[model samples]
Target: MTPSQLRSRIKDENFCKNIISYLENIIKEDLSWINPAFEHLISVSSDMESTIFGSVSNCIEDKENTKHNLSDEDKGEQEYFYSGKM
Candidate 1:
C-alpha cells in the first residue's frame, strides 16, 4: 500500500509512511507466490501490530485454491491474475 492510500484508510495516518515501502515490497513478493515473504514475516512483523501477514497468506492461499477449483468459465480469471503478477 502507498503512504497516501494507507493514510486514507488507517486511523493513525502518519504511522504507515515509514513502512509503506516495506509493505509494497512484501506484497509484490507475496503475489508472486514466493515463500520468502511469509518465511521471514515473523521476524520482521513486529512493526505490524495487525494481522497483515496472516491476511496476505490467506488471500494467496485462497487464490491458489480458487484456481484449482474454478469451472471452465472461471478459468480465464486466473490468467488475468497471473499477468498482473508479472
Candidate 2:
C-alpha cells in the first residue's frame, strides 16, 4: 500500500491496536525470522546514508576547488565579505 493509505489505516484505533497485537505475537513466536529482516533493514539504511553523504562530500569538494581557482582579487573580495567587512 501507498504511504498515505498506510497512514490513514494507522490512524484508525482498531487497526493500530490490531497491528500492535500482531507484532507482539510475532515477536513472541517468530523472533528468529524477524532478526534477519531487522538486519537487512539496518544494512540498507547504512548503505543509503553512505551514498547520500558521499554525494554531498563530492559537491562540497567541487565548490571548494572552484573557489580555490578564483583570482586573488576575487578571493580577497570573498574573504572580506565573509569577514563582515563588506
Candidate 3:
C-alpha cells in the first residue's frame, strides 16, 4: 500500500477496532492455534501500526520540515554543480 493509504488506515479508529475484534475472535475461536501464533502476529501487527502511525504523525506534524530536508539536499546539489566538483 502507499504511504497515504497506510497512514489513513492506521488513523481510522474503526479499522484498528476491527483488527482488535478480529484478533479477539481468533483467540476465542481457536485458542489452541492462536496461542502459538498470536504473539508473533500481534507483535508484527503492533509494529506495523506503530510504523504507520508514526509516518502519518510525521507527515502531519511537519509537512514543511520534510520539504525543508529535501530542499537542503537540493542546495547541496546546487553548490556541487556550481563548484564543478563531484
Model 2 lDDT at residue 25: 92
Residue-level lDDT of model 3, residues 35-86, one tens digit each, is: 7778898899999999999999987788556546667778788678769897
- Give model 3's TM-score versus the native structure: 0.37
The full ranking of all candidates by TM-score, starting with the best, is 2, 3, 1
The candidate that wins on lDDT is 2
- Colliding residue pairs in candidate 3: none
What's the CA error at residue 2 for candidate 2, in Å?
32
List candidate 2 segments past 4 Å from native. Answer: 1-33, 69-86
Instruction: Give the clashing residue pairs of candidate 2, or none.
Output: none
lDDT of 1 by residue, 1-86 (tens): 89787667676646666568678887677455556668678666765645787788899999877778888767776676778964
In terms of lDDT, model 1 sits at 0.72
Comparison by TM-score, 2 against 3, better one: 2
Rank order (by lDDT, best first): 2, 3, 1
Question: Mind giving the per-residue lDDT tens digits that candidate 2 earns over 1-86?
Answer: 89999999999999999999999997788457578779989999999999999999998899788997889999888899889977
